[model samples]
Target: MINGVTQLEILDFSHNRISNDGAIALAKLISWHKSLQELKLCNNYIGSLGIEGISFALARSPALAHLDLRLNSYVGDEGGIFLCSALSQNTKLKSLFLAACGLGSKAGKFVGEMFKVNSTLLEMDLSNNDLTEESGELLNQGLIKNFKLQKLDLRMTNVSQAWEFAINEQLARNIANSTRNNINSNSQPNMKTIEES
Candidate 1:
């Protein structure tokens, strides 16, 4: 099916019975069409090996933005770590949904670190997984440093309202602080100009 297609942009093969071979076949298409933007392969049998191929494709496609690999059966901590490695390099990606993909405790930490340098990502959905308090804490610290994240969904896990509130408050403060700095800088410059005049 992939052989005949030329200009495929958004391919959603989620909830299917595909395996590594299917994922590899799709991965090969990235080389042909670098303009592909979104790729969703949720609820499939794409395990670590398949994700490896997908990661290769993602590394090559600079324009690809949104990638949804939720509910992949073999997606565990190791798989999540592997996937995050590729996602860290994808600077143009705005939304990444890996909900219910079985990202365990260890993988969640790595995913949190992935957000450190990946500032272009706007929305991330890590709900319905096994994220613990430790993982949430890591993410909380990460959120404090990440200035670009707009929405983060960590529902159905070990995260509490308190943690969420703390993170959101920190984000709000960061924005307020930046605004104050900008205002101060502008006022100082204007005052100096007025004094000279």
Candidate 2:
């Protein structure tokens, strides 16, 4: 059904029953179409195997910058690792939502690794998952290395309130630093005035 159409920038198939096979097809389409910028397949039945293809496609996609796979419970820790490992190399994606994907402390380790290398991602949501104290600690450690992330939501998850608070504070600091950097970059000295002087 998605063959005739081409050059789609945004494709949202949220709240559907797209399972593993469907996700593979979608991954093929994502790879075939280079202009696709945003893909939302939240609330589906996609699992770890399905996510492997998607992760591979997105790792190489040049235009895809936003992705949402929330509520896909089958995409547990293994799938989460597949995504994080592949996306760590991605430089275009800025926003990601993976809430309620049954992610745990193991996935948290991969996420920490992802944050260490990924500099383009600005916003991410991993709320309502199985992230526990261990995961929270790992997440904190990862955020310490990341300076570009501006927003991260871990609400309704197993993460403690204290950890979540600390993460949010770190994100706020990143935003402030980014704003300061932009201002400094934009404020160019007037060479003409200096020359006149």
Candidate 3:
């Protein structure tokens, strides 16, 4: 079924010009392969319908960790919404790349909502999208509650200068907090050393 491989872990079909039908077929394949950990469908022509199929497949994939959907510009805000909804249920996903996927402010809001509850996602790239100041604010709201997210890329988006400033401030605060905690832990005397003394 999969070139003598029963349990596939990673599938990379990027730059293949695969459209809706191909995406649907891939989705079906993924549904049967639960061992899939990473899926890359970048630089394709998949649209909203295709993304819907993928989203449905993702809902059933418990082992999927990394997903790269970059440069699929046909999947607009609606597709982003569907994908984000699926991601909310996927607890194993750690890194998500959605750059240049025609996402807009509405999609940004959906991403924010996903981040609010998703505990496993560590890295996300949303660069070169249509996100604006309002979207940045919504993202900020989610960032305020999400401490598990370690990296977020928003380059070439429509995020405002003010929002960037706020984000930088928040990052600085988090770094300072972590540094202080590390310093405090290091300053504590070791129990073994104290006993010897």
Instruction: List per-prediction Cα lDDT, in the order shown.
Output: 0.78, 0.88, 0.85
Backbone clashes (count) for model 3: 0
lDDT of candidate 3 over 128-175, digit per residue (tens): 999988999988888787766767888988998788677656556656
Estimate candidate 3's RMSD in Å: 4.0
Q: Which parts of model 1 are misplaced by more than 4 Å?
A: 1-6, 170-197
The lowest-lDDT stretch of 10 consecutive residues in candidate 1 is 27-36
Clashes of each: 0, 0, 0
Each candidate's TM vs. the true structure? Answer: 0.81, 0.91, 0.83
Ranking by lDDT: 2, 3, 1
Superior by TM-score: candidate 1 or candidate 2: 2
TM-score of 2: 0.91
Could you give candidate 2's per-residue lDDT for residues 1-197 as a string of tens digits?
A: 66667767899999889899889989888766767889999998999999999999888877888999999999999999999987788888999999999888889889978998899999999998887888887888899999999998888778888888888888999999999999998897888988999
In candidate 3, which residue ranges exceed 4 Å CA deviation? 168-197
lDDT of 1: 0.78
Q: How far is candidate 2 from the true structure (C-alpha RMSD, Å)?
A: 2.5
The model with the greater lDDT, 1 or 2, is 2
Best by TM-score: 2
Best by lDDT: 2
